[model samples]
Target: MYSRSFNIKKDLAMRNEFAKKALDANPSHPQTNYDYGLALCNEKKFDEALIYINKAIDMDPANKDRFEGFLPLLFMAMRDTENSLKWLLKMSERDSHSRYLGWLSCVYAHIDDLDKASDYLKRFLDERPEIKTLSDYRKVAPAIAKNL
Candidate 1:
């Protein structure tokens, strides 16, 4: 709800405070930790966010698939292109049919690896021919298109 508010900053701050309180009250709860970590991520506190997020993942390894794809985006948000690429690669290895080929291209583009980016883009297009332009890319992966 706060994420879609008119006063986004204020709402996000309020949401973060509430999430922090919940986290403090339930330190071992995976959902609480995940919510707090997500709030911190929204505030751009990447390093701190990582601790809680990783803890939540550790506590719930059975659901790791729910976050594996998103971890690369989080690393990208932290401007850790290497880690982003590594995570994306790991995700691809884990699930070849996953919708990350385009994300791979975007990450490569961010690192100025146009050749790899083009190759990945071609692969992505082969899988998703409907995404033919920048607008389509933005709709699917805006964060990945940040560098582009």
Candidate 2:
């Protein structure tokens, strides 16, 4: 509720406060940990967010796909392309959705591996040709918007 409300109102401070309180009450709770981690990430505290998010994934391995999706984005936000690629590769091993392929293309582009980038991009386009506009590309893969 707090997270949703924060998203609606764009209230960072309030969201951070609520997330912190939730974490304080149940430090090991997966959802709370993930929420707090998300809030920290919004604050650009990537390292701190990574700690909580990793804990959340560890506490609830069954929901690893959810948590793992964030890992690559976090690394990308930190401009750590190598780490981003590493997490993206891990995610691809577990899931092969078209969205993942699009991200893989972006990450490959970031590393100047245009061959791999073009390959993944081609696959992604073949899978999701509806994605056309710059806005659409930005919405789906902001990291690769330039490449698109």
Highest lDDT: which candidate?
2
Question: In model 1, which range of ten residues has the least summed lDDT?
Answer: 1-10
Per-residue alpha-carbon lDDT of candidate 2 for residues 1-148, written as tens digits (9 for 90 to 100) = 4664785688888888889998898887998998898899767898999999999999999997897788888887877889988998998888888878988987888789999999999999899989976578777664423332
Q: Write the per-residue lDDT of candidate 1 for residues 1-148, one digit (tens) a residue.
A: 2333423555777788778888888899887787788788767898998888888899889987775656887888888889989999999988876267888887888789999999998999999888889787777774433653
Per-model tally of clashing residue pairs: 0, 0
Per-model TM-score on C-alpha atoms: 0.80, 0.86
For model 1, the local distance difference test gives: 0.78
Residue pairs in collision within model 1: none
Query: After best superposition, candidate 2 residue 61: deviation in angstroms?
Result: 3.0
Question: What's the true lDDT of residue 90 in model 1?
Answer: 93
C-alpha root-mean-square deviation, candidate 1: 3.4
- TM match of model 1 to true structure: 0.80
